[model samples]
Target chain A: MNTRFILVLLFLFLFMPCPSQAEMGMGISGRTEALVIEQFPYVYEGRFSIHNTSDTACLYVLAVASPYEDVTEWVAVSPAAVEIASNGYADIKYTIAAPGGYTGDYDIRIIANGYALSGEGTTGDRPVSYLQTSGSLRISVNVTHNAGDASLGTTRPHEADAPAAEDPQPVDVGSQAYLDVPTDVSVGTAVRLRGGIIGHEAPASLCIVLSSPMGESYALPTDYTYTFREEGVWTARLTLPDAPLVERQIRVRPVRAAGMAGGAYAVAGGLLLLGFLALHRERKKGQKRREKSEARHQTTLSSISLKSKTLEGREMPKGL
Target chain B: MYQKTRITALIAILALLTIPFVWADSESVSATAGINPYAPSFEYVEITDTELSISSHLDVDREYYLHVHSIDKNGITDIASLVCTLFFAGDGSLSAGATDTRSCYTLTYTYANGTANWTSAPAGHLVEGDCSATPDGYRSRFIFAFSLGKIAIPSGDTNTWKVSVTIMDRSGQTTTYADLPFDVNDYIEWSGVPSTLELSSTCMDPESPWTLPQSQPVQAVVTSNVPVSVLFCGADLMYGADAIACETFTLETVATPAGGTVNTAYAIPGAIPTESVTLVDTAYGTACMLDPTLAGYCNNSAGIASFVIDAATGATVPYVPAGTYSAVWTFTLERGAGVTP
Candidate 1:
């Protein structure tokens, strides 16, 4: 009888409604696990079809997880998180471009994390007290860096290492212009807009210009000098005759006021403390002098006050 | 007198025969058209807006939806066909059939309208929209319902879906229009893995003695499908005095939410917030980046929230007893407008 009842319980559990039986909240439709890119300054295009096998709508977020920081800079994907209807799917488009100088093969794994929250908005009651983030889908990207190819494209300015374009439009551009100027500086101060052009050079003259809405303007020379006569948002451009190779926005701030608004109160508090200390010291000094005089008079004329009067070289003092 | 009456009867019969032809070719948003059908029966102007919705599906369905509004329904009688083309757009625009359009969207088609059933679009094709115009509105302001499902999607295709509804008038003049830029994807991955939350003394810089160590905030990337807010389940996870009070925990924005309607009422502003004490003790947990874009999976620049737990309690992180702390979290789905799994 006991055995029969146990078997019946097992049967019921097996057929019970199990939401977990479906495909996990999120899944990748593509069969392949690895992605291969042919060249350096390499630009790779691929797709990730996220399938929501569960009965509920799910959200998935993609993030790059690799030891190499360069891999993160190489990839660009659109629409951060996707919410697909039950059994429905959506595609994730990605563009991967490696820098110019990198060579050899490196492994990169991009993770797609799925989320479904139990709590409603800011006002609703939640089943749990906090949000738990888990469940991930990964794509192992294997990038091979051979020689340079203008066709492959790059994620960053290749001038530091490689070039991306062919001519005016070249892939893996090896030429780069860098500006080493601070973003905020005061007026009347000479701010040297220090920068350089690296990698391949254009056939035209390299120059830098500071432009602002105000009348202040400067087409910099080899010294890279710029004297800010006014305060405003200034645009710094590194131009190579035809186009501005690199541009940096700087805030030229006017000199600050003499004293700080908030700090002034603290300064006043310190001054009051010093005045109290000085007054206290003076009182103590006066008390000591009177005490000394009192002790001396106590041995002679006890009735005499500390204040004494001397006339014709004769000191006179009594009860009066 | 008998001859005159007979002539009038003959003229009446002739007039009736020509009137039916003129009425059949009447041109108006509500009228039947085209005794002479033009090159295109329908005129297309510009797209107003689109949203991904479930109301578009009739019998079976698609993911993205285009609610097409025609300024004038004139000359258009019936929806001829829906051509869902999938292609590798090397160029940016998803034109009707540019030189670079790939041919794999629909393998078998009779190339005509209605009584037609697709064998089902192949796997990677992005769209197969079903849109039809009804005479419910006034002559010039008819709303044509356009529905798109993901029967097809090509890889690395961004904004490559061009869902044009083929509209025809009574005279059989046809026109097709609607370019839908949806960020749908099959291949996807995150820009980075969940960052390691390191709040111990090791993270502290030895060179700077006074500086405290701050752990990055734990975050949830909110979706646009609904008004989303993060619920820190074990509020006790912070207040429990196992070792250190979780008050030093902070919310950080790793990426900004793309095109999300800021719920000015639902969230606290600022890209990064420094309110750990108020969050730990308060009823509402700390909100990461609350950009609910009514949501996509892989755009790194799109917007991601990083929830950090820093050991830096103000200028100095309180001393914590050395030990390993672990937590098991279950990420569930918040389905519907604001419904949860």
Candidate 2:
């Protein structure tokens, strides 16, 4: 076992001096994640780059698509097809014309299909073969027509989005997904909430509709301080575009003065004073009974003495 | 003869000094204090290509300029601070408030054999390329090489950019390459249309009046150079003496939400003699978005343009004179966003 271990260590040490080799492949290193626009009907200038570190020059064809949108038609690339020299790079440029009227978010995928130059051209056309190698990047197209629509979350470009169900409503959506509201707050304390589309991406401004205790909703006034004046478990409901219905209840606690309530203190003080008066009255009654019993004892003793004196007088006379 | 000998000695000293200057291109630096006056300059042989010209000099209206390069080595090194901080100078047109910002980048290299190496620029610095400088013994001088080739100009910046480059050595001495001006173009175009729409007797129903979709939708391209809108209209369909009025058809993108009635987003105007009606609009005139369920926020992605016939007018398929109705349809592209009232 020692000999085998020694041989393995020697073999690894000998190979450590050699430099590691790289493989022929492709990678993209540019704005692969986002292209968010607002108040469109204007152009959006975008860019990305392709790195083909292969020995032989390869040609790349680019394609943009989305499963649910026509983003491919909305975008155009200057050099949709490019030829990168060996160990070289090709910079790509694309434009997105965000139209007005309708507003929402979209996920656009830019796919680069690469092919070897020498492959096949029997008909003099670029040879089409089985996909040799490819690189792709997903760009989240977050467009809003409203100047100040809050977008709390941008799409995760790398991961595939959860497929939306038909008649997609926020039936199972949590309030935290749409609005960020506190579960607990003190009376007269301002409830600072932020929401439009809630997640990581911080939006500049949010459109809010605060619900009344009576279940009526009103566009929360800009200068409206969201303070809870009274104490109760009040529920506020909010609705967003595409029917994301989220309702959350906040437990509003009454204001405490110096860790105690004034009303409680008043009730406690009144109860203590009533008890003191009742005890004082009871003591007076007991004192009066004691005095009466002492007077009765005095009268009975005097009467007994008089009776005794008479009996003594009679007895004395009899004895004489 | 004594005077001539002194002049010859001076001449010999001068001849010996010119030897290093003559072979300075390939010559190694000596224990000398100063370098060649033109050793690291923009006017050097390898610095031949100075102008980073546009690809299409004739066409002055395209949004992006891909990979503008001056690959000619202009021997200087250690570039710091690459900022892409020029916004629309025309007017603050892009101010939609806070999320209106561009991106920052860095550079990394991978070898032909796949050995990856990181070449860094501080995060948020804009340039994306490899920059290297190796010192060649001289405390005051180092050999520098740059392979930078990218600048994505946004369409809103309509004016020329006057850029200035400054290079500094470790010894605090500097070289200045002044005034490299770059001009960008602005333009917009799109392609790919859907198959034809078919109309028939089965077109009208009071409950769900939308007709069966005939074909694919118009594939709209996104671009930053110019804003656009798609409009559609057709003549009256006539079948063997039977004529159907054009107002009977409607084009819309979104389906009606449950319980609430959904109106067609962009409806076609009256046929032929009637002015064209805008379908794909840039002036957020109609709905909030294309599909709220698909994208969480306010997004305007294009949807299938479905045609619906009006049943509210009391014209059912049986009540109207219907046959194989046909009319020539024409779609037009027009200036949108900025031009819309």
Candidate 3:
């Protein structure tokens, strides 16, 4: 038995290079080479590359841990980490817990182990990692703090804007301003408004919110009011309402509107009167000229007939 | 008399209203009936043939000239400008050159097997050809060689081209030559790298901020005249204890995000890496979600995620498998500490 054992030992020594080759042959590299974590005061995760370097195929196991104590209070344990495989390499991913008040620098590292197993009767070779020769991967963590706040304030300019503000009734002392009709009425018969206009030319329209005393409300047409350019000349006129309103207690607000009927009538009457007087005056002058011409013609004709009669009488006496 | 007087007054009023009396009579007359509407017309060439045939091994250091001339509706012959593009077929190669002549181009070639030649020269007479060998099809192709000065076109300009030869017959007939085939690749050299980039990530969140870790950064840069956008980046993550989670960050090619903005991403289909690596530790009942503040975590969720293709590059650098992973991944997208939600 001793002689056979010696012979076996010699054989083993001669072919021992195969085992070394197999050990170096089986290996794997992680697929991912980079990661970005951006949650502040929260847990961050990263992945490491695992490459298979040995000739014999083998499974890989990966582990991650905190390389720095001061940077983080919590460390990444077993369940929180993951290992994956592709092409001969496995990836070991690590997640760090959220350190709410944590700031500054911290190092994260990942370690991978590769192993090859054979036979049903015997266990496999012990798993090993390329940590020492291949070197471990480390990541830099930067925790930032929040600064102060900056804001913008409201300082807007104020010009003239009606309706947005309260709509107040304009007051005039002397000139009459048109007031909106209390009741709605059709065209032809003008309903009088009670407000006064302070300018000479009436404006086109004004806005009035009218509501029925019974709770019903309607926005009066803004086109119903008129505006005047001149200052301090107030006047009011009756207006033709668009439609008839059944309610008598309709709330009416005075708004400026153009004079509807009075100015039009005055203009028409003045033009008609001036035209008639001029025509009559022209006809009279024509008649006087005709009369003078007729009188002159009659005078001339009478003088000629009288001379002819005198001549005839003188001739008759001479013949006798 | 009264009627005539009234008539005269009515006519005067009508004439006053109709005539533009404010303008001088000479100016008004000239403005109203100035030009003759039935004027003589002329014709022009609208389009040109976009195809050409040259030697695949053609030397790009030399100049090549192509000429095209068209006849108008009145049978007046006029020169036409042809803008052509040259491409290679098998091992695709392209090169472009400059020329000194009115209708010639000096071809520069960078790609090996084939050549592409075109001109950026002034307009000149275009050579017209009849491809009667081919039928009345959209494909019109012909091969011709002419020497103006010492510009010699090699013999094998046949196989690698699709020429679009338009002919303006002497009778003022305009025809379009489309999809013509060619024998050789005209040599042209294009310098400088691509001007765009494509960026992709397995997991991403728009609401959360993102940062690339110094260790696993997915960055490809172009140092020279080449634009970085032409570069493509792809990433994969293995799920489980070391669950794979990767984020790809790409710089916006455009200077501003809101101005003449450029797109910077392309989403690759079925290329997302989302497997979970886990220890299956049922005994320890701890459900650890991916930390938003962690590096490489696309999200705290447990599914495989892939990034869309970057608008800049068309490459997917690292690709991973897809599935629900048992492993936990933590990513932290924390903004400033006091950042409001």
Candidate 4:
């Protein structure tokens, strides 16, 4: 029975939360973990979270410090002393004033020193002893001048270079396919779309669905070329409308081109066809008039031959 | 029961180790201190009151002033004496082979009600003093005038000087303040004809279109003390009054009879009368001549550029007011073709 009791107590010690373990430590966190400031003759205001991680009430002294002596001289901390309740947190404020005509990098750190109150109900001016569980947290602040060049190390790469998502799993849309389309296009300009089936077999039919900036979708013919009249960000999607396959969408930015409008080409083509039809009709009318003239001459020759034959018969009777 | 007692002892030891110990208490004073501000600052003023000319030589006989005073703040606490020293750098030699050097001069002034006594010291040495008297008011002002000849500066050398003023209080606290840079040089000389050009009001009329004079002869002769590879000469039209109506003017170098060349005319599209405008910039013009030897200098005579007022408006607005508009024509002589001396 004693052994069993010891085993049960050990299990309870392992599972139960210990109050003494929670009562003896301090912690500090910053609202602004890192700062990037530009320009001089400027002021920066920051706040930090200071908590008594221990279970007992504690007194804390907050101070603004820096590795750079010049920065330390310019930084000011408010509410330098505070009393935090057990397992409670407090916020401290700090201000940094940068002098004019000085351009360089400045790193600042905010330090909170935790101590044990010497007496109960201790308020201001209470002597405190340093705590063994005191903690130090550092919040890095970077300050620079506007006229100076910004450090390029903090910049991120362009989002366009990110790898494209893998092709969606094939659905019931006939055979799988992929699309090859330009990511950039100009408004009122013709763009070509080229794609083929995933395998050697060609799909029964393939079409393109264009989603415009106005949230409108268009079902375009299978023609490889298309011209967008509107100017904005558009998404060109290649899909098999008859088949149940996933469609591929590509982003495009359409810009307005100079000179003739898209409709101008259609109008010019219509005018050329109209001119050719008019010329062909005029030539057909000239040929019909020539055939009529030839028939009339042939009739005239036949009438002359008939009259000559009658005159010769009359002249032969008179001579007998 | 024995095992439980041992576990309890182990837990107590761990708790004791985690808790911080408090030593014997003793009575002590706990005081909080704040930052203290102390110091008496003053502003400095140059006594010459004129813009320093780079080309004109400084005359050693003329007295120059260095004034320091505090109008807002009180003077140094219980001031006993104020000593002023002027330091000269790059003033030593202009010889073709001499190395540059620096030197300093000191002059101590004794405190009085409104006046002070000056005691000059040898060059490169400081003169120390402790006058018993003090100024009547809390605000203090000191003016020191000294001649450049006393500094032993070599001829034809360019010199830069700065002044440091030190104040000693009764408690022996000494604070020194340094002034801005002041330059003095002796290099180039130039002279112009007609000393001054007066453009009559009749030449500037709203009713009649105006043109520059073609016959009135005006010229300038520029000479340099040292050899220069190229020479740049121009004139700035300094107006006497603020413009009321128009803001356009033109000046052209029409003729150069003394082997000088003329380039495109200088035109001011929108000029402010209160500010000076360059009527001619010969630096980039045909007037600039190259000397391959780098030993030749500018000693040639160039014609004075002609001026036409309110011509750039192109009949868009009325000519400048009928008042007798006066302008000062100041000529500039630079060393290189496009460089300012």
Top DockQ prediction, candidate number: 1
After superposition, the stretches of candidate 1 with alpha carbons farther than 4 Å from their true spots are A1-24, A27-62, A66-97, A104-107, A119-320, B1-39, B42-62, B66-166, B172-341
- lDDT per residue, candidate 2, B61-131, as tens digits? 21222221111123223222111222222222231111111111122222223232333232322222323
Writing each residue's lDDT as its tens digit, candidate 1 over A76-114 gives 665555666666667677777766533334444444444
* lDDT of model 3 at position B243: 24
For all candidates, state DockQ relative to the true structure. 0.05, 0.01, 0.00, 0.00
Global lDDT of each candidate: 0.39, 0.39, 0.28, 0.42
Q: How well is candidate 3 docked (DockQ)?
A: 0.00
Give the Å shift of residue B259 in candidate 1.
41
TM-score, cand. 2 vs. native: 0.28
- Candidate 3 per-residue lDDT, tens place, A1-320, comes to 45754664565455433222123221211111222234444565544334433333433333343433322234452422122222243435556665442333444444332222110111111111110111123344544423001111122123332123121111111111123232212223333332212222333343234443344444444224322222222222222242111111221223322332224445454565566557767877888878888888888888888888888666565456
Per-residue alpha-carbon lDDT of model 4 for A134-164, expressed as tens digits? Answer: 2223345565545233433232344552223
lDDT of 1 by residue, B93-159 (tens): 4344431212123322222444433322543222334333344343222233322232223222222
Candidate that would win on TM-score: 2
When 2 and 4 are scored with lDDT, the better candidate is 4
- Fraction of true contacts retained by every candidate, in order, equals 0.11, 0.00, 0.00, 0.00
Docking class of 1: incorrect
DockQ for candidate 1, C-alpha atoms: 0.05
Q: Which stretches of candidate 2 lie over 4 Å from their true place?
A: A1-320, B1-193, B201-230, B238-243, B252-274, B279-325, B337-341
- Which candidate ranks first by lDDT, i.e. highest? 4
Query: Would you list the rank order by TM-score, best first?
Result: 2, 1, 4, 3
